[model samples]
Target chain A: MRVALFITCLADQFFAESGVHAVKLLRSLGVEVEFPARQTCCGQPAYNAGYWNEARSMAEHTLDVFQDAEYVVLPSGSCTTMLRAFYPELFRERSSKFKQAEDLAGRTFELAEFIVKVLGVTKLGDGLRGRKVAYHHGCHALRELGIKQEPLALLANAGAELVDWPASQECCGFGGLFSVKLPEVSLSMADQKISTLPRADYLTSALAGCLLHLSGRMQNHRVGLETTSPYGLSEVRPLASLLWQAVEGAA
Target chain B: MKASPNNYPEEAALVIREHPEVRASVTGATLNFDQNRRKAYSEIDTEAWRVWAEAVKNHLLTHLDGYLRQAEASLVANGVQVHWAEDAEAAQQILARLVRENQVRTVVKAKSMLSEELGVNPLLESLGARVFETDLGEYIIQLENEPPSHIVGPAIHKNLEEIRQVFHRHFGTALNETPEALAAVARKRLRDAFLRAEMGISGANFLAADTGTIALIENEGNIRLSTSTPRIHVALVGIEKLVPRFSDLAVFLSLTARAATGQRLGTFVSLIQGPRKPGEHDGPEQVHVILVDNGRTSVLADPEAWETLRCVRCGACLNACPVYRQTGGHAYGYVYSGPIGAVLAPGLLGLEAAKALPYASSLCGACFEACPVRIPIPKLLLAWRSRAVEQGMTPRFEAAAIRAYAFTMTHPLLYRLAARFIRYLPDQVLDNRVVPVVKAWTEGRAGLKPSPKSFRELWESGEAQ
Candidate 1:
């Protein structure tokens, strides 16, 4: 299957490694991965901020870029959900663009959801062992994409114990630009989320934008937990390359 | 300290930011209200509530004219005068005439957003009649001379310390900063006004068209006193508050309390059809039902915006709104705030004044989910936005930007080039002088970084492979 990668702007700029891991993971599953370089931000920032025209521009760019791909996948659930869900509404009046947006949305999938549900690849050819990981479900992914269990299922397959994070679905207060616009409220919400995190070895989620906000706060607070995307954890080759390598090798 | 409705958004934003403590207090209060409301709704069978509520609302709306006539006839039969006000001015004149005819000097009122809509209190006071707000929350705001920030919790924006200060200044009484202590003082102060006032004015929660009954739901007991103590009781109600049957009350009764305060029922739900019976010991001598259209009929004509009339004024949507949480209800620059308020203010007030209300949401759909009557508030808000733009009510810069956007997005090559160019701009250039209009977006957020390569470039280059 030829899968087009929509490495969201956040992932491209800040979390490049997630992009590499996504490509690696898809290729490892015997899927042909195509990067659509014309793709930029999904226009969600513009759309949510009531800059509908800018968002429509971005949506149009995205739709045109991935026009030929059999399936469009993104590592960030929020961006994919934006593409799959909201873009159609943006172009509801313009018949041609509306149809295009609808078509693009219908074929788009969040990374784990596409892999586990569509591709049916639960266990990769490799695994990481002996790590207790807590999953932070991004609000859009949980509510919009409905990719709740697929990420967990893939984590379990990779041999990581999923630590239950209380209020995991609560927003980390990184509502795109909401953090800057309402910094005090955003910081307060983020602080509350940090308090809910149990002491775990690793924290992970698919959307890197959320991780950037969470990890930035964690760094500022000097909290001692390594944060990584699921793609980062899954793409660790040979199953025993890190601290859990010896455990995997012994097994 | 009159809150003139002019430049209200800027004023509200200033108020919200200037008093960080009030902002924090409203935020905390809203969070608690939201949680309690969620718990209350969850306890009930939501599906059942939705069906029943929708059925009752639809029935009322479809037969609105007939029901209004029936209610009028029934009230007349009960010897209660039913007066129709075509608009706010007419409503005010009718009310003022009634007050003058009786030579009423003092009038006490229960909490009523409808009265606020008509500016009834000030109008009556201007007519030389003293008007007192009897609800504890309303009384605090009336003393401070501000509008109710939250629909149901009128004083939700004021912290206990603020309330204590307001009470100390207005009532000349020393009271501690506790709910019970504060309530006692307000009750004592209002009980006299209720007893002495010859005319009572209250907002109706629901006016049963079939039974000609006006329903008043309150957690505080002032509404009952306001209705019963005065010799003449006048209930001012919006035309949209009418419901066809007494049976429909059960659905509204369930939804209103649960949605507003997360209680199975409010402390008091008073249904008054007319004045005192002959043998009645404590009841008003004359009951007047003033049905005020005041732009509601015009709103009903717009199919896209009419669902706003289904609102029960529960404030559940206000509590659940993200924007309302951060900025509080005041920032919406209207008596109504949150999702329902956004759609409502423009329809009732005019799009020119309330244009900002429509854009004040993330379209999270939480309000729609929270609405007991299942009003699709977010959709209506978006529709209002589109209408505002189409009507040239949006700012010129925003309109131009959207036009540029619509043009560029339809063309792929221009978009790709623009994306590539934007990626290379320095952070300083991107973050230069703040765009005051969109300061909400670029203020604290990570400035947008133009991607090094377009998704198309990467895809065409086979780098993705």
Candidate 2:
């Protein structure tokens, strides 16, 4: 399938490594990814800040850039949700724009959602060496995309033992601009999130932004646990070896 | 008069920051409430729950006038007086008239956000009636001369230490900073008021319009005592609180208890159909059901905004909201706070009064997900923002900005040019500068640093692919 990769501004700038991992993982899954050269930000920052017009412009830019793609996938759940769920509402009054927005939303999917729901890839060609992993379900993915079980399903298939946290669905306090806007509140909420993690070998989530925020707090507090995106874990083993090993084990 | 709601966000942010202990207490309490609610709701099928909840609410709202008429007739038949108040002033007058007619000197109130919304306590106090708040949380906030932070947990913003101080200052007794001790003190203080008060005033959680029944759900037994011991029991509720039938109560009752406190049922779900029976030993002689409209009709008229009235006021959304969890309920600046409050307050009290509230959310959909009655709170909030702008209630600059945005978005060339310009803007130019109207965005936070290379540049260079 020809896919338009919506590398959210967060991934493009801060977590470029996760973007690389996503590309590698997608290519391994036999997906051809296209980068729309004209795409800028998803306009979530502007939309969330109540700058609806600025956000609308950004949304329009995104729509114009990737209007022809067969499938639009994003690494970030929140941004993908913005495109697929909220962008239509942004253009509610304009019939032509609304149609475009609807079309974009209909085709767009979050990473795990695209993999599980669209691509039907339960078993990614990935392997992990017996690490007890806990999943941090980002608020947007859990609530908007409803991709709660898909990532966990993939992680389990990758041979990682999943341990559930008490409040796994809670926000990691990286509410994009909210982290800086409400710093103390953000830190406190992040503190609560980090504290909720069970003592596991590694913590993983689909959204790199949430992981970065949680990891910053964990590092500050000296929690001694590593955090990675699901793709990062998936890309560690070569596709041939991982698939062959899985086949051999199954036989 | 309280400061305009427009000034609330800044003041509330400052208040929350200054009082770290109160914020911590609210955060702790809300976190548990949120988690327990999730666990409880997960036990039930979500789709079925939504259908059941929606059916009950829709049935009630559709037949609201009919139900109110039936309830009034039933109450009157049972010898309880029914009064209709067009607004808060009329409601206050009705209460004052009741007090004068009965020659009532004291009034005991169970936790009522409606009363707070109407500023009822001060009005009653000015009329020479000694008003006492009966619910533990309500009593603490009452003593402190503050608004209830959370809908269900009235004094959710108060910690034990603050409660102890309020108790010490009010009762002139040394108090300890513990939940049990504070509850004991409040219980002791409120018991006398309940026993001697001539009138009991409480908010109705749900008015069973089918049978003229007022359902009061309380964890504390104070509501029961307050309603029973008084000579006159007055239940004031918004017109929207009516549920069409007694059977409909089952759905709401189940959703409310689990959604509010994570209990299978509250310790007490008192269903008072009317005034006490003639042979009844311990019940009020007169029961009055006061239906207060107070801007609800205006909200009801707007179909998009009307779903806010379906709120059970369970505080589930407040607990679930990331912004509310961080800033606490005070930031919303109304009697109702959190997601429901953000949507409802603007419609009820004009958009200008609550212009900032619609922007208070992260639009995370947690509020919608947590809502028991399935109110699309985030959608309503965004709709309110649009309405606010259309009504010329938003700041002129913001309206112009959005208009300019709408214009730019229609033109692809302009949009691309703007993006390129944004990319070229210096980090210093974008950094740490407070923009007009949206200073709320950068009040405590550093501004976004401009990107050296736009996503377009990287994409064009084949780096992002």
Candidate 3:
């Protein structure tokens, strides 16, 4: 199936490699992925800050850019939720725009949900077998999209050891504007979430926004472990790429 | 008391820095309440019950004036004096007038957040009447001369040792009095307050219109004494507390008890219909019911915020909120706190008095999940935020930045150009220094840096498909 990649502005601008990995993973699984060049944002930041006029305009732009796509996938659950859940809300009083939003929202999915549910692929066997992975359940994905088991199911199928962290469902406090507005409380919440990290080798999340806040804070403290989007996890690579020695030996 | 929620940053910082125990206590208490609330509702359809509760409240609110009139007529017919208060000052004035008219030298109070909202105790004391709190937690805080940090457990922030000190200092009890000892001391001390007081003041948990009854739910029997022992009993109730029928109490009573303390029923559920009849010997001689608006009518006028008035004040949302778990109630610097405060304070106190409150939450939504009436607290918070922005309460720079960001997002050419421009900036310039708008964000975390290549550049490179 052909898909349009809704790489969130954060993932596109700061973590483009993850976007590349997402494309590679989708292709390896035999689904074609397209990036809509004109797509700017789903307007989450604006919507979150109560800038409805700006947010609606951004949504209108997004809907226009992705109008032709049969399916749209984004790595960030929050962005996906923003489009899928809030677009209709933004256009509530306007029937024509609301209908358009509803249509586009139906076609949108978070990357992991799209991969597992739409692509119908759970395991990418032996790519990064035996890596101890801890999943950071993004608040929107966990609570809004109800995306609890999909990422873990896919990771386990990919031959990774999944460990659970205490208060895993609690927010990492990177609540868009909330991170900047109430920085002290935001940092305190992040610290509480971070305290559970030592047990896992790498933290995985479906959304890159949480990773950005978490990794940024993790870096501030000089923590040893790194965070990755699920697509970038080594487990999804082909066997040849997974075994570095095999690629080198063949060369 | 501060007249504005603008001090939230400094206040939140202080609460976080000074009160580590507040976090631990609030988290523990809320988690326990959540767990128990779930278990307590195991036998029943909790969601369906919530729907019914919501419908009941909505129906009452829809015909609020009718129900209130019916209630007043019923109350007056039962020989209970009814007073209407348009605002907090008016409510206080009514109570002050009652105290003056009765020549009440001493008063005993049950735990009533409405009274807290009215600032009644201090007002009464200043009016030359001695007021003593009869609720155990309220008594503890009253002795310590501090506002309650938690609604139901007013002294949840205080440990047993702290209570012991307060009791020892005030009642001349032992320094290390146990919980039981502290309770005994409170019981003994308040016994006289209950008997000597010429009047009693209470906040009703629910005002049942069909029965013309005021229901008081308490674990302690203090409410019984406060409303019964004194010759004059006055109940201060928010107009939003009206329920249509006596039978409606079953759902509300269960939801309230479980949502609050996880009990299937509070130890005492006193429903007072009116003043005692001539043959009655043990109850109060006069009953006064003050139906308080105190900004509730304004809250009701905002359709988006009207559901906030549906809250039973069970403190469930506060207990479930992560922000409240961290900052406690005092940080909100108002009568209400947590998700309810975020929603209600803004609507009641206006954007200026509560603009910072709506921003205080991370929008975690645990409170919504925990609300008994299923008030969409997070959604209400967003509504308040929108109102705040409309009123220009946000910082000018922040508003400009958001508008600029929105403009860029809506304009593909500008967004693309900005994206390309940002990519060429050095990591140090982008990630090391805090920018003016996001300075608070980068304070305790690393700043964000743009990727070397945008995703559009990658997709166009045709390396994947």
Candidate 4:
């Protein structure tokens, strides 16, 4: 299946490494991956801030970009929710645009959900081992998408030891406009999550916005933990280098 | 004691800083309430019951006039005097007139949020009537000479030490008294006030239409005492509190009990049909029920916002809200607090007065999941936000920024150019705290560092493949 990467604006601008790792992980599993250059954003900021017209415009732009793709997968769970759940709400129910949006939403999946549920490839051949990790389940993914076990299943398959993190299901305070709009409550929420964060070598989640907020706060507080997405944790190599390792390991 | 709902950001910030110790108790209390509610819900099909509960509330809201008329007629038939008040001022006037006509010098009150909203205590006192709060939490707040912070747990924000201090200062009790001792003092004091007072006032949990019975749930028997001890028992009820049938009480009782305090049944669940019967020996002689609109009709007229009136006042949404959990009830600057407060206050007070309340949420949706009636709180918050924008209540800069963002996002080429342009901006200027408009975001967080290169730039340059 050809998977079009919906690298969220956050990933495209700041955390591009996670996107690079996502591509490698997919290609390693023998899946055709394509980058839709026109894809910019899922319009979460505008939509969430009550800017319906802006959100609709951005949503339409996204729909036009991924119109022909067989499967649209992205690393950000929050954006995926905006697409899969919120897009239909942006348009009238009986409108043709709403139908098309629903069709797109049906095929759209978060990276981990696409991997475990769709691709059916669980174990990644012992590439990740002996690592104590905590998966900070973003609120949108856990509450909105109902994705709890997929990421855990993937981590367990990769042979990573998952530690108990406090308030794992709570928001990391990266509520798009919320973080900036009400920074005190946002930081306090993030502080609450971090105070409960069990000591670990690595803390990861699928959404980069969370990782960005958490990693920034963790750095400020001098908490020692490598924060990244699941793809970034695999075997410590770029996709190109990982492809060579995959070939050599198969031999 | 003034509500700062208009300045939520500052008020929330102040609460976060000043009430540092409140965090643990609020967290512990809410978490406990949530867990107990979950367990209580496990005993039955909570989802199905919630759907039924929502339907019942929706039905009552749609046909409120009929149900309320039926309730008033049944109440009159049951020998309960019924009065109508169009708003808070009118309600206060009616209650004052009742007190004056009865020549009542002292009045005992049960936990009544309506009275609080009406600012009844001060009015009564000003009218030369001494009002004693009967509920332990209400009594404690009454002693403190402050507004009740929470609907159910009025004194939840106070620690034991503070309570001891308050009791010591006012009741001249020993400073080393335990909570049980404090409760005993309040109980003894209220018991005396309950007997001496000529009139009693209380809030109804639910007003049953068929029987004209007011169903009240409380752990402390203060409501019973307040309603029964005086010659005249007056119940202040929001018009929206009416349920169509006596049988509907079962579902609401279960939902409110489990949702409020995780109890399958309240310690005292009183369904008073009317005044004392001829055969009755101990109950009050004259029972009065006042149905106060107080902007409810305005709420009912709003197609989108009318759902705010479905609240059972169980305080479940307040306990489940993360913002309320953090700031407690006082920060809301209104009688109602938390997610429900955010929506309901605006509906009643209008967008301009309660504008900040709608923006106070993180939109986490915890309150929605925990609502027994499934009120869809997050959706209401969103709707309010849209209303705020449409009314042009947002700051000019904020409105302009959102429009600019929308413009940039729709045009991908512009979005890409902006994205590329943002990468080159220095970290110093990009710091959200120092930035004129984005300062709201960085007040509590360190600034973000933009990525060095756009993923599209890399993918197009053949490095991504």
lDDT of 2 by residue, A1-251 (tens): 99888877655554555565566567778899887655557877556655666677788888998889999988777888899888998998899999999999999988877888999988874464365667777788788778788877776787867776775787777776556555555655665666556756566676666765665555442222233332233222212222233223321
**Per-residue lDDT of B100-213 in model 2, one digit per residue for the tens?**
999999999988888888888998899899999988888777777878888888777777777788878877657665678768778887888888899999889998766778
lDDT digits (tens) for residues A1-251 of candidate 4: 99999988888887776677777778878889999777888988877777777788889989999999999998888889999988998886549999989999999998878887999966665544665667777677777779888877777666667787657777677778877777777766777677776656567787777777776665553333333332333222222222222222322
**In angstroms, how far off is B321's CA in candidate 4?**
1.7
Q: Each candidate's lDDT (Cα)?
A: 0.75, 0.74, 0.81, 0.81
Candidate 1 Cα deviation (angstroms), residue B377: 1.8
Q: What TM-score would each prediction reach against the true structure?
A: 0.84, 0.86, 0.92, 0.93
**Fnat, one value per model:** 0.12, 0.18, 0.68, 0.50
Best first by TM-score, ranked: 4, 3, 2, 1
Weakest ten-residue segment in model 1 chain B by summed lDDT: B437-446
Provide backbone clash counts, one per model. Answer: 17, 0, 2, 1
Instruction: Compare the candidates by DockQ and give the number of the best one.
Output: 3
Arrange candidates by DockQ, descending: 3, 4, 2, 1
Q: How much is B350 displaced in model 4, in angstroms? A: 0.9
Chain A TM-score of model 2 comes to: 0.86
Model 2 fnat? 0.18
What DockQ does candidate 1 have relative to the true complex? 0.20
Q: How far off is residue A36 in model 3, in Å?
A: 0.7
- Consecutive 10-residue window with the lowest summed lDDT within model 4 chain B: B437-446
Per residue, candidate 1 scores C-alpha lDDT tens digits across A54-73 of: 67777877888899999998
